[model samples]
Target chain A: MGNNPHDAGLTEGPAPMDEQLVAYLDGELDDESSRRLEQQLASDSTLRDQLSRLERTWDALDELERIEVDQEFTRTTIEMVALAAEREHQEEERRRPARRRRQWLLGLAAIVLACFAGFAGTWYFLPDPNRQLIEDLPVLQRLDEYQLIDTIEFLKLLRDRQLFPAKTEDASTVREASPVVAAGPSAVNREVGAGVAGKREYEKNRARIEAMAPGDKRQLSDNWRRFDKLSDEKQEELRNLHGALQLEGDREELERVMEAYCEWASDKLSAPELSHLDRLLPAERIEQVAAYKASPRRQFGRRDGFWDMARNPYGTRWFGRGVSGSSVKEYADALKTWAGRYVADRAEVLAELLPREEGTKWKAGLAKAPADDPEQVKSRWIYLVRWYLAGPKQDMPIDGEDVASLEALLSPNARKFFEQIPPEAKKREIPVGLRRMIGFHFQTGQPEFENLIAAEDLDRFRKTLSVDMEENLRKFPSAEKQNEWVRFAYFQSKLPRDARSSRDDRHSPGSARPPYGPPSHDGPSGPRRGPGGEPREPGDGPRGMRPGPAGIPPPPADQPAEKR
Target chain B: MLEVRDDNAATFEELMLRYQNRVITFLEHHTGNHELAKDLAQDVFMRVWRARKDYVPGAKFSTWLFTITSNVAKNAQRSRSRRHEVNLEGRDSGPLGVRPLEAMAQVSSGQIPARALDRAEVRDVVWMAVQSLNERQRAAVLLSKFEGMSYAEIAETMGMSVQAIKSLLSRARTNLREVLEPYFDFGSPPETSDDADSS
Candidate 1:
């Protein structure tokens, strides 16, 4: 009759006498039945084992029923609960914003609203909490980063339209096809206009010696100025004389000497002579001297040999035509140099990431807890973390055992550092405080982030970053820029409440936002390419008709300190 | 990466504060040490918070939440280091060495201790056996033995599926067997000895 078995049809072996034991122990069993079991158990080892198991089960139940927690643990976790509430409370209060329509009315607006409500019976509608956050009732822009960006943008726009002519996007295009490089005129050019021999004598003497050097066109513009300055009588006399013996009025002897000297000169200097023949020769039925410089052997127009030396730089640069082998190789070498910088650092972000995700969530709550519920809620906590001071002690190389052990102790947490990180990338969590500035989840190969950093001007821009954010920006710059773009990231991550924007700016010398060391350098260094590597001219985007400034030179990329 | 949205953390904390005192009382009773009990209570809160990100709303909140609480406390107690340590030093204080349970007795059975157990020896013996059980064994005993949790409900709170929890309770009983063997022979058989040993 007592061929009792393991829980009938159960996979595991052996049925526990646990239920009966509890009933028997609690005296819930009827006296006759309890007595029968007591009689059987007196000598039965198997039944006794079952009984023992049941009795211990009862013992544990009793013990667990009566245990309590430590006073400190309860108080501490409770305090954390209160903190989150307090912060949220303060934030909600601070986040209150005003209506623009109300602002438009100003002193009269409130009255107008009242009047409209009274007369038209305009029952104003308010949106749901989520919808209110969505609607542009008032931005969170009244304070912190948003406010600062708003002002800066306003000033920038004002300056772009008012102070500067607004450098056109095509201005760079004008660089290559350089207009005549008219500089401040030389004194000789002036003296020549005054028709003085003072400069001409100097040119004639220089030209005599220069004429001896083969193919040399040294100081052509200079000589031309001096020659123009020489008194017309000296010029006319020289023009009439023997060597100046107007070879059909090739009149300028200096011109002949300079051209003859070009053939023997080491290398050409000035460009070939220009076709301003009308000035050199009279509109005469005159003879030409092909070999005027060498009695019967040479030509006398300004030497046309130094063509390469006097090549047009603007044309070369604009057309990309004049690529001297030397400089072209320099650019190629530089490209190689840049490629070498692509190294993979060994440091990982897992340690920073996982704990924050797990710890903060754990710190915050129990399942089914309401946002404002103070009691009856199971407030989560980073208990082992708090006990062991887990956040700071975590190192990248910790063993999985330690990792799992630590994890087994705590719970999930809030988006601390990398709030912008997508769900999938946040494999491990970071601590709340460090997480704020650290959790951007861009993978190494993302093109959007890469292209932005690859722009020519990124190097220049990187040089300007603040130290706090620079190291972060280095491994991940474009995202950092995006972090900057949403003006609130710094304010969000850096714990704005604890370190309020310094009202006195820098009353605390050793503080995070200390007295100014240097100005923030990231105002865009000229224009840069977009995520697609397309050149993003500043002013052309959605913001306005103009872009960021051209001359505000971005800081260097190497300096980690200024990145933030 | 446990992604606890900031909003979720706030929600979780609210959950903790709501249930903390009761859960602490439960943990204290189970662990027999207020400090360990509190620590276990915190674990329950943290576990629920961590796990709740995926919590679907179909189940009763208390059921789901308590399920986690009970599971965490049991697991903590069953951990290798804690395996041998029993909750012998119950922290709940009251007249007659049972304040919390006395309150429970008032709520459940409604019978004063005097009416239920006139003999002090029986109560002492009952408590002595209870102190010998391990964590899950104790929880199984309490929930089933005292609080009257179904195998299924006990399974949910302890994070085990029903079958697994059942097996666990069975193992817990086996553990309880050893502690109860001598006690039972000493306590219950005496009443029946008049029929046998006396004969």
Candidate 2:
């Protein structure tokens, strides 16, 4: 009757009795409902029977008893709660100063913004033609007129041009017009009868006479009309000695003159190079300075490679000079190799960090992937490198559209692994191939590398390589032989599997190892071979077959090219 | 509640003493283990103390107190499932007393007359019947009988509506009547397995 099949005989055709019965048995019914159920129970045997059973079940739950709880339980809980509160209080106190500093920075930024707005408004709206004309006045004036003119002569020209109007021939008028020169023979008095051009010439010579020293001034006073036309360089040289000539003590004057040439040389040297030289002992500093002066001037043309640009301290590269193009390429290759070495080092670190199963999976991933396509390999490497460099905690937002492509390229686990790598490790252990790639990519305007390798660092790297190159040249008979020696250096350093230590001494190149280039997927295998396709010796390869160009100086006769 | 919120330690201890026995009784019936009930009761009071500042005092103190009790019970039940302990043998004594099977045998002995069970036997019989119900029904019945809460008050404490509470209690009573009617000698128990009463 009330969709109440589950209630069975309790209800006929009215509201369901299931809830009513449960409530009634629990004494939850209102007064009206309670009276109604009571009346029904008195009249109906079936209703009374249902009520009786429900009451029995409800009353049966009274069997559960209140048991005693240990007193120590209450004591320990209160202690824990107090400790938690105290910890929270300390944390809040620690954060107060940091919060105050953030507020102060916000206030300062607002003040600076307001001041800039006001200054911009004034500069844009205010316009005065007289001010504009004064700025433009220089373009209208002729150069020859000012060449012989001192400060006073220019003011007279200003008046002659009617830029300033004169009042009369009064004392006050002359004082205001030329206060600096009023005590001398005034320009106004000269203009009264003398030829205008002749008067200009007289004033120029008079100004020169006043500025000269006592000896020159006395000679000028004797023949004030004629002046010697000394060359510009001689004039500058003479002027440089002027302070010393005026010294009161003869001994001090002589000392100053004697040190002038050294002062001139100091200005010509590179500041960093000179500072480094200063740190050396006096004897060493002298030798270094001599070597620097004798070092041939390298043409650092714009066409020259990055290595040449690195060698020049001032960073000026001309179009036509320095090392040959091939040598520049060789240095560039070494940098690229160094970058590759860094990546390999990081791979070793990664292998250690990965769990056993994951490490195996990663190795499989690398082995299964194609190694022939360099671009694909590079892209995969870059993806890992980019994620590694961003740091573990970095949250990079990706568009919904990009999710599929990223998932296709890298597995979710691999992506998470990259995120977990700490950035501090990335900075300290720059992957060998990454630095050169970053430098080259950033050459096209990548700003991320600004912190990685600054200009100063690049210069230092170049200087070290340049020194290595010089040493290499002196060790080999020719440039071709040196290049050949570098290719086989790594393998030759270690003897064949059975070779003895005594054999190592026969060909060891000492501690001077050649720069190792980046490893290729199909790197050289087996034994080493020289450029001529012959097995290389331990130290220097076969030499003295031919000499290179004139620029390469020969080694000392006692140490032959083949003996290195 | 305000005294505890203000860090009055004595007031908090007094409150704990008043409610500790009631909480332990409810949890023992719900879990069918008196020892676990005592531990869970301690946890409930600790939570109340920790969350004292958050209390608004809108509801009765018992209502707030029981809410935390229900939460701790539910969390412990979930962890127990994940751990999947196959047997809890040799741990017959719970927060209350002996195992339900042993209690059933003691109550069923020919020596005890129907309707004349001793207080200890009655408590055991009732606890055995409570274990027959599911977790929610057990909690609902414990709150109603032990705490003396009405349908609406139980609903508020358990985060359910009054109508739902009434339905829950009805089903719970039907299940209990079937399990308990035999002990009272009113009717025979239906052919049922005791495996479902392992709680």
Candidate 3:
């Protein structure tokens, strides 16, 4: 509609003519514009050329590839939408329960308003049965234990007297420090919190009750009925006892004591006598129980058997089973054979346990001993086996001096590997390996000192030493001494080149190499001394020089070991 | 579409079957990445499913669907730019950087030998030229050229005025002409330029 003749013909630069030309190519122009564009295209060569270019470029867009999505895309999209819908539905369901509870409360309120006096009487005299069950669920869970005791006072008196002793020999030692009465009310209160804890306990009890089988549920209900008939004072006492027994540490000990007492009372006392004792006061009842335990009539024929049974009810009666001397000999021979095989398997670790002279002599004796001489072989096997078993128990604390000696004994490659461990990790890893080396030397007897030295580092330690050092190490009479020299050489190599030459001149190989002494706090070659220049401790001898049980020497403290 | 709005699942599936290929094709051309296009196409359909309860049946369903598609695509492009990971297929060139066709521009401008390009090369040239357009211009051109929507429908799909869409299409065509006209007229391939027109 504009009167510019230039606009009718296509011009550049945001002109309406460009839009008209594009629209004309797209067949989107109005009739008047289409007619005018056609007339202009026929006469104006520039406009025709411009239209041709637009038409050609627009058509070239068809060259872009057509794309098709696979069936999986459709399937996954449907699944995603379905999952979203299900989540929405679940959200609605979660909201419905609160709404239902509100409606129930409103209905209850209306009924109460309509018949206040009647509802109050019913609610007071016959409270909701389900609510009562939930409130008493904790007691119902332990109804069987409560049914046996007349009152908590009686149980407390029984525990105070220590009438039910531990049935096992070791059990007495384990439980001696943690007596049932020692756990005070404050401890119990600390263990169990109020309010939130109470609600959680109720929910837990309800879930357990609901999961019980129908027959068990019926029996529980029966117990509840019997329990319900007790006086309110008795019910309160039983509930208090149950809550006290729920304390974690005391529960197991008290349960065991109760079990032992129950078993003994049922076996010895008559039902009438038991009932009579229960009717007495807790103090008098416990006194009577103690008297019955010590009675001459109860002990006349079966004191030893009863005490033995009390001491170890689950233990096999190996001592009382009579056997011939020949049978005993046969058993001893079998045990000797097993011990010999075990000693042979751990020969390297056992060798490390003795002094250089003793170990060399023992190895020579074993090599020369006649294979068919059972007596000599048995004696040799017993020597090594005794050393293995009679060493320090597995749980012994690793001495810090022993750990320092072990660190001084690491080979060059192992030292490199050990130094790379972060300092915090070294504190943990060094002790674990040292403990295994000391306590389970037989198990760690495989090559490479498996617990202490990594296999690759051990291999490199043996393979990478100079010809002179290897020759010097081979001259040592025992593996332990050879290891000490390797460690000394590794430390020597760490010194500055000039200092090493001076130290080597003074400690030349033939002049009796210095004893494997404790590491010095000062420079590498300084005297080994404690912080105040005191002498080293007794156990600070060379590796494997520490005294073992029965006067035998245990293995030298080896390298810092790690669990593989 | 009304059935789909009423939560008719079978109708939704039918609609997906009808539109999946078209939607994926449009997105693939729009984003220059087939896998991302598939992901974005699924996202578009997912939004439609989520907003089904609010869907009103006035505009054409493809138009409504493309509106969601346009928004999803733009959001993806915006985030991709924010991450500074806008290169096409890990090539150091795309709409926001130097165009891949700069090398081809060198070839067209006779710095390199003018060998006859293959069909796939020509297709790639056209794809790069399309991708060089700005986000809105690219969406508009794709909707117009592939979807065959009128200027009004493109305006509705892009949430722009009819005049803006007209201007957008005109500039896009003019850009394509600058890049592709030589290829269409001669054996030389299309070259993307530094100052290629974009809205």
**Per-prediction DockQ:** 0.04, 0.08, 0.09
How much lDDT does each candidate structure score?
Answer: 0.33, 0.41, 0.51
| Candidate 3 deviant stretches above 4 angstroms | A1-13, A96-564, B88-117, B185-188, B191-193
Residue range A173-260, candidate 1, lDDT tens digits: 4222111101101232224324544334434434343453331122222233233334555433332231111122321222233222
Better of 1 and 2 by TM-score: 2
TM-score winner between 1 and 3, please give it.
Answer: 3
Across A20-111, the per-residue lDDT of candidate 2 in tens digits comes to 77788788889999999889879977666666656766665654555545545545544554455445445645677876756645543443
Error of 1 at B116 (Å): 11
Model 1 residue A186 distance off true place after TM-score fit, in angstroms: 99
TM-score of each: 0.25, 0.34, 0.35
The most accurate candidate by lDDT is 3
Q: Ranking by TM-score, best first?
A: 3, 2, 1
**What does the interface RMSD come to for each candidate?**
40.3, 44.0, 41.1
- Give the Cα-based TM-score of candidate 3 against the true structure: 0.35
Highest DockQ model number: 3
Q: Candidate 3, residues A1-564: lDDT per residue as tens digits?
A: 123343332213346777888988888888998998899899998677667657766766755666656557867776666565556555655677776756645543443342333333443555554555655655654554454555556666667788886355444553332332222112243244245665465555566668876644754564565456456777776666765665545565665666567646544453224445656787788888898887743311111111111111111111111111113234334334434544554555555655556555555655664556666555454444333222222211223443354444443323443455555544444433322222222221212122233346445656767564464345332454345334323322322233222222211111111122223211222222346865333223222233221111222223211111
Using DockQ as the yardstick, the better of models 1 and 2 is: 2
